[model samples]
Target: MAGGIEKLTALKVARLSKPGRYGDGKGLCLQITKTGVKSWVFRFERDGKERLMGLGPLHTVSLADAREKARVARASLIEGIDPLAKRHEAVASNKAEQASNLDFDTCVRLYIASREAEWKNPKHRQQWENSLKMHVSPHFGAIHARRIDTPLVLKALEPIWKTKTETASRIRERIERVLSWATTRGYREGDNPARWNGHLEELLSKPSKLKKVQHHPALPFAEIGDFFKAVKAEKGVGARALEFTILTACRTGEVLGALWHEVDLENRQWTIPPERMKASRPHRIPLVAATVALLKQQVGQDPTFVFPGAKQGKSISNMAMLMVLRRMKRDDLTVHGFRSTFRDWAAECTDYPSEMAELSLAHTVGTAVENAYRRSDLFERRRQLMQDWATWCSTPGVKPKTPIGSAEEVVS
Candidate 1:
């Protein structure tokens, strides 16, 4: 195997100082750079392309060591193998093996960090971390992500699957996502243990079957007029915000995150951007005179927020309206429940079309195809419906003259 190898000796290599390659035969050479720094190189031709593989510097790799490395490379070439490509494969394998040791908690943190920017809401991010810490982390937070199996995932979810099905379902989804991310990153392999399809579905009861649909406790539509009258008489920004929310039939977060910039008093409209909306689509609310008047009362409060919090520059706390309800001895009612009240009144007591009521509430009216054809938000019709609602809300003992069974009733 020697052939023309061992052409350069140790004593000759040490004395070689010119800025050029000195061949030691068999694709091995000593390289002297322009800066007088010395290194060993293995120059080989693969598929007619010459490639230089660095062995090491003169200070680290001795002449004998470089010879042994070159000999191995020649042996590999004889076997029709590229030593450089083999080294790269070995390095990648080592990295994957190290990544396999990444713990569940670490994976969760990394996954959340990677996706944090995409999640617009701080509360949503908090829910992810908090739910995992409270429910999942306790079970197998320290376990290696690759080792997490169906039984381990079940251990975390079984206790809550029946008692807190919704939360358990969310945790299961989060775990599946993390495991999927780990798999993609080469930290884990195989199917996701937390998957709810054919895998976990056979083990755990369906979330829908385990949990009953729980509606927010709402005030009866008949009592909303009296409730609205009483709430109007109550003090603070919360009461006014609550009044505006009811009149607009908006969600709690939509009302709380309301900025003065979103409201156009001249146009009698409030535009909520897509990021803040539940459906991730922009919504336009047709404001009634009652809502406009209520908002006007709040003009001097804060420059940014429509309903300013006690602290400067922040919007009102999410619990502010609920606290107002508590103060009014209406602990049984939720701020969200007002939307149901409005929907009921629109369905049972009005001559307005159901689509008008749905549009006023900022709800999707029909299928995607139907919505594409029905381009209009029905703003003009919604405005009239909202005005009637506001007038009824302001009237304490007012009854719906157009009952569901009456001749004047048009809504079904």
Candidate 2:
């Protein structure tokens, strides 16, 4: 409270020309910059550091206003609070409150914008936007995203939950993500009503219960050789992709997304990177002679994608393999079914251990304790099993004679 005498009048402040701190009284001063602009400042000491809090421009904040602000700031200093820090908190609180009023559509846009880069597939962004637009936005697009509750979410989901179970599930998940983003961004508060584990589970029947479990139609193990013959007879990138998929027993995405760089011809192996895999872990495949031959046929001098599409620098469409199956009039089987066929063939006709076969399919197997001890991928053992499978597929009428080795011998 001790400072310069109250020497500043409105007229004196208005006419002041000196470009320096002009004290009024009790830590209040008029600051004139070298550019001739004037403002008010309240000087205080906090934790041994001198701090200046801006009151406002002299043109807008009158002498009386500046004095009152300085009084409040001094009072806060006595209370051991930094008045400038308190003002910052107030501004931030106001901004958060304003942002919380953003409607569902706007929040969706912001959430997508913030997270689009992290999504692996560009099509995933389109799927999110389309699902929200088709199912959610029509009901709650204009409602404040924070204001949405269980009833509002149910309103968007109930009509389709039973009828379009898959689509409804996707919409519910997307809503949960957007609401979660909103809450984390300080735009919303409380539990996310869109969550399924405990909240929506009570409201809606389980998706599995609503819709019958539909497995991908698979080729029977005994008929794999015939299917392999038909797939090999066809030509084009799609056909090659399908044949490679069957040979490797990999997921369709892994085969189609394959690049020449991932293939090591010398090692007879294909390494699928973690990002493109379903388990999000790197999987190594032991390529057989036939698979290596197939890769040699598909390889070009400077290829980006092993299975190039109609568009330059792009992989084949996700539906390309399915169309191949359709064109061959084998609509009874799915492209993914080949994995099951390989699994069956390994289990029944070969002397390979189940662990080796599972590893061949890139599946996580064994108990946690067992896996902890099983550090190796059993890559060499799997190479022989895959070789036997490739030989069986290529030779039409020969039943695979089990190799003369016990599971223990091969695994050890």
Candidate 3:
């Protein structure tokens, strides 16, 4: 005992089993809870009120360390500062720091959501999710965004870098974007670990050097008429959609996502909205008589979609045309390959200007400067081109003469 106060010794603290606070000299004490949990506390009075500050567990903090901490708390109280308030502020600051640090997967989702509106195609968002889930998520998803260093990103990319170069490149770009987003949002700091230009270029081979470009398998232009006939013989929304796709030389997604409102049967034109276009620009397709008749037949069946799916209020599956091809036993051909077939036929059989053929396919033609000077979409000339195409497609085994004039002269 010192100054009529019992000093808590290490031996006494270890032997004490009662659930009460046992005092030591200078306001330090050992607290034993009802559950037999033992911890150190620094007891003091400030502004005429007694306050107890938890130093730490008895097992972790030695008796000497607790006494030193008590001396510091007592000093703070003498200086008119509440030790409990100071401790609380420190704890809150640490919690705030932890709360601000987002994990990699969470950062990925936030980054995607922020840029969703800028993405032209709905599939682009899906592609981001699929790529990140397969490549980045398994390795670094749980790690704090700030802690994602170069080695971790390299580990995620190295396996796929050689085997799936294009996919690996896309994943690396996405990870870089997420990390950049985190840095800008204050969730992380430092140069992005996934940066490619000067940093990752040294680590991985150039994408161009590693990539082997593969084109879609297309049916020969001469065989398209026979294929069109086979598709026309089938019955269903998908069949009609497929036949319409061939007639217009449009992509599968374009035809399947078609809405009735976009069709102007009297004018013989179908105007695809900018959002639906692959180029992110509105496209006007000149429909021939055959296409107009097909639209008329499909009109009253569904009030919304030109090609309704099995589910209500939805467009047909993107796979619908492929399934039709499968049924026709043409497993080698893809629905998108028809556009290539159309391009081949225009080049080989017609005197149409190359620009018209490209425009009919809704492809962006010319450089930005050239496009700036060009104003017209040449809708009337395209109408004639499509009508001639319909005539050729309907009459199999017939070779047609060259058109009288070039597309530019015809349009003028």
Best by TM-score: 3
**Total backbone collisions, model 1:** 0
Positional deviation of residue 193's Cα in model 3 after best superposition, in angstroms: 3.1
Error of 1 at 242 (Å): 1.1
Single out the weakest 10-residue window by summed lDDT for candidate 3.
399-408
Best by lDDT: 1
What's model 1's overall lDDT? 0.89
Taken over the whole model, the C-alpha lDDT of each candidate is 0.89, 0.87, 0.88
lDDT of 2 by residue, 302-393 (tens): 37888899988899999999999999998898988888888888888877788888988888898879878987998888888888788778
Per-model clash counts, in order, read 0, 0, 0
Query: By the TM-score metric, which is better: model 1 or model 3?
Result: 3
lDDT of 1 by residue, 105-223 (tens): 99999999999877868877899999999999989999999889999999999999999999999999999999999999988889999998899999999988977889999888889
Measured with C-alpha atoms, the lDDT of residue 206 in candidate 1 is 90
lDDT of 3 by residue, 140-254 (tens): 9999999999999999999999999988988998999999999999999889889998899999899889887778888887777777777889989889998899889998888
